[model samples]
Target: MSDFLIDEELLAAIDMGSNSFHLAIARLDHGEVKKVVSMSEKVQLAAGLDDNNNLTDVAQQRGLACLSRFVGRLSSVQANRLRIVATNALRQAKNGQDFIDKAAKILPKPIEIIAGREEARLIYLGVSHTMANGGRRLVIDIGGGSTEFIIGEQFEPIYTESLQMGCVAFTNKFFADGEINVKNFNKAVSAATKELLAIANVYKEEGWETVVGSSGTIKACRQIIINLGWSDEKQTITRTGVEKLKEKLLKYKHISELDFEGLKEDRRAVLPAGFAILYAIFNVMDIDRMMYSDGALREGVMYDLLGRFKHEDIRDRSVQALVGRYNIDIKQAERVVKTAQKLFDDVAESLKLTNEDSDLLRRAAYLHEIGLAISHGGYHRHGAYVLEHSDIPGFSQIDQNCLSHLVAHHRRKIKADLKNEVLKVGTPALVYLCLLLRLAVLLNHSRSDQMLPAIELTVLNEQQWCLTVSGDAKQWPLLVADLHDEQAQFKHWNIDLIIQSEKFID
Candidate 1:
């Protein structure tokens, strides 16, 4: 038991939400997360959006300050054990990269701004973990700028949707003056219902056995319902409770004077608007009652990080799914992957590369010919375009760019313009990796199991690389021709590629 528990190490997650920032530290006990500590601050980063949809300077400063404090407490956690995620606020910000750069300087880990559907998937994971044994569960999370709806069985999400309606954003639009009335409340709820209408039909048809809510808004709403005596002691927010809360909230006519039994001071400003959104969701989606879940996106991030270490990486699954969807050639991909790995191992130490670099080489090799599915002519460009533009799950924009560069130049004539662009973003390491990938693809061009000669790669200096092939090189004339062609490409990048055979040795 002690040995098993030792493997279940401590994990931490930071959720930089639109409305708030949260940090959670947990320990895995019997496959369940036991919360050790947690912290949250009302950042309202989404509400700081300027007219151009960029995060305001004040908002960026506030976010950075909060992350600095969060980083202080995360001193014990390793970079790999900690996961940071940004939500709708960063997603909407045109200057998101600016803020990300500032935050990365202060935080212990890099932040991943997940896509909306991915957000829905993680929300369901968090909700499902906290819920009791049940059939299909419908999970809804109303954030400051977006709301996520998901239906899942056990731990796997089946349906996920994200709608652009939330507490803070709605408040700014409908109740920014702090005045709340029946007409304004109705307008807000109507707007929320309109957004839900897009997915309501599909979710209804799919159906669910239970409904669960997560995040600050839902937690606050549940408390209000229980304190107002509208629901039972079990803490479930019922439809009747939501309706009554709306009626009571409308009586105030202003957010400042709005006093509710369970409303916290921090929640007072967004309460009316959040309640309106919840009311619309319940009415539109026909939710009878929703049990609250303590687990949310941050918990899901930690769990996902754990999975990566345990070899259940979603990125691997996503890559396989892409291959299956594109109908890529499995045998050819395996051949390329094998050849790339073999070359990578030979020069990796001399190249000063990490395991991650090796992994990147393998993935690029596997998907190199994916563009051939589009067209045989200039498929490398097509593949690069797809990778750069496609919404590949589990891949960041930077990750996609790196993969795109590798695939785009794998077999092409490396032009002067392409060399400059590659040099701008990557170090010598990337250049070497790209060279290895190109050589591997060239070697496997025949795509047959004829087994070529054992090749050795040596880095002579920053400006040159050498490949020595030993075996019956004369038997494969095409292989020899490809190597000669690759030499021209090496010249374009200011590197020399030398192919040595027994003839050269003699």
Candidate 2:
């Protein structure tokens, strides 16, 4: 069995945001998360993004420096128990891979760049966990490069959306000179309004009992209003308070000149842009008041990690939803899954595959035939498209892409180009998993529940492997022929796949 350990005593989550990087360390106590440590730094990674959407060297350096500090505190955390998630900046950066490679050297774990909707889901999760449980609530988080809005009840999010409007991004777009004039502020508001147009009607129609705001921008804004005495005793962000703040912002020609009691020096640069987005949200969605929530993406990730260890993985539900959506052949999927599990178990330790790898393989096996629902011809490609494009809540874009590659190449001719593509993300290990999946699918070609020969796999090295089946050679000529084809396929990837029967080896 593959050896992987989770630090049940402590869990850590890192949020590599566009504007800042935050780390939260916590321990689960009596079914509750007790935070032990927290750290944050304003890296402003998004502000360094160029016209081509590539992270500048300066931004990469800042991110690496911050993560290096975070690494120091993670010495005691288990690799499997910590999750580092990146938001819009990394998602938009063309040089994200280079940055990630640099960060890998300093971090205990690899960085996972989540999709927009997934970020929204996590933000909602964080907010829900911290806030009182009940009623449908609207949660908004304005990050450095993107903004996420979620509508959820208790611990479940009913709707989530992420828009390409954020403090740093909007500041760069409309307030680059640090000017806070009426015309520029109105322009920023208009830009933000346009971004919100797509979801305004739907959010308003669904309605929410409470309006909540998360992230630094919203928190800072709420504090500024409270300090200015614009808000009443409740410390709620009201529509009039926002208007008053906007009026004060309009009076200042430059952001540097605007000095409020609660606004910090670093936040002044992006305050106008953030406020414009908030103003647009209020106007478009008709929000009367919004309460700030201390929870956010980092907290959500910690809880999510906790859930995974608890065997309440949301990804499993996501996979099941995909299965039901496509009307897949359940029996065939089970057959492939059973065989995949057996093969995985036999060589997991020898191949150095982790439980995560096994889970990915099993999920892929279950959904491999989903594309067949679309068309008999090129069904693999169809399935890949669906998996890649669909909004799977718990899976990251990388996870979706990984599944897509496996599904696309499961049955077809294994092309060198495809292998290279999978290598870019999956590495050689994932290719091994894919090969295992292919063998399982091949073994279950009949798609019947009939008992098959016991099969075993042995991994001698990176590029060599063997499979042994417990049966007579003459009884399964078709299976023998398929194994020979698989052997040739593996040969293209420079892997020697040896097939053996009870008495003979081929």
Candidate 3:
């Protein structure tokens, strides 16, 4: 029923959620994301996690099969215009990379695993766009592997968290036998409440003016409650409605026995666990009522992609935030950023680099000194840790991981083992980017307004680079020595750095 040919200006996002895989291909109409075609399949990937936390082969097959189906739907979309993101299930899986590798074979783009807080941030992004300027709001999305809680104004999230509580996970944990009894139900509720303990006080203190729920679980609950006449149509999910739903759910002998008016067939099994988690949230957060939002993570990913196309990227904001929070030397950072940009521009076409790669180098330049906020010693390692662990709003886990490596090796003695790891991800020219940042940093070591000598960088091959130093060659002794010394470090990563200069080196 949907045609991409009708709309060339389209953005596509695939949400590889724990319980489902969703695809939304949308085009911008009047500055709003309008879905040309949206599809969701109940892959239930969380149910495939073994006791060892490895994604089982069957589960991977299920996910891959779903993606293969989605590939047909995505035929009209360019690979560059699409984003694929996996949430908590894959995040918790030991063999997540294994799954992603297989998925990479069929999907338009490689799947990106987002951190929990980043997940919360995107979920809030989607919800905020759909709301009608509704004051401060608390948005909750319960997936199969985790639950996201976000409190934000219209577009800015004040607090965000992805708690380890979800329908599929809880069903396996608390309702394994599928016994529809009050004891099992209460156990799930209590477990959810315990999970919320750390975040409850913060959400309450930061307090939202209204509460909104999103994703399949909440949508199913709202539908069942409103259809059953437990809650009026005006109140999709109220405390009273949830309590009544729980009472009715307990009346069933087993999960398969659930037969509510508006309950979908697929949601029947996970309903009890989802309801329990929602009930716990209601009790812990003291919520009297909640509204449902149609927007969610996939929608959020689409909007984020659209923003990047519009040059209103949130990752830029994140990098600026890091610079300010860590009190990075702004002038020094600017120098490195400018030099890095120039170097990247010089070697970009030769190395098949992209705008995304350029952006990565620029962001890493800005946050290179982020670790100085902690301590001057091994600040590079500190910055890497922060980038890897911190909730950078618009960055995927892979991007953070790449930036971490770039920052980690920017000024260090690139360890042999780490060098191998860096080389393993050579597609984005990460090693070359590291080398460029190092050169940029080295060239700006003086940290003064005095302009450094004009230098041009060119790639000789995958493993070789050439730097041509021009301008006043007399002021190049210390810089020449620094560049000479950095060459050995560059060689450590199996990259050859050839320096061309006149009358400066001994």
Output the number of the lDDT-best candidate.
2
Clash pairs, candidate 2, are none
What value does the lDDT take at residue 471 in candidate 3?
Answer: 61
In candidate 3, what are the lDDT values of residues 300-340, reduced to their tens digit?
99888877877788999989988888899999999999999
What is the number of backbone collisions in each predicted candidate, taken in the order shown? 0, 0, 0
RMSD of each: 3.0, 1.9, 2.8
TM-scores of the models, in the given order? 0.92, 0.96, 0.96
Tens-digit lDDT track of model 2 for 1-506: 21322334778999999898999998777766778999999999999999999999988999899998998898777788899999999999998999998898888877889999999999998999998757999999999999999999998899999999999999999999887788888899999999999999999899899999999999999998998888867798999999999888788889889788878888889999999999999999999999999999999998887778777889998999888999998889989998999999988888888888888999999999888888999999999898889889889878888898888888878976677888988777789888989999999887777778778899878788989888776766778888898888898888999876655445
| TM-score of model 3 (CA atoms) | 0.96
**Candidate lDDT (C-alpha), each:** 0.84, 0.89, 0.88
Sorted by lDDT (best first), the order is 2, 3, 1
Better of 1 and 3 by TM-score: 3
Model 2 error, position 450 (Å)? 1.2
Model 2: CA > 4 A from native: 1-8, 503-506
Evaluate model 2: give its lDDT: 0.89
**C-alpha-based local distance difference test score of model 1:** 0.84
Q: What is the lDDT of residue 352 in candidate 2?
A: 80
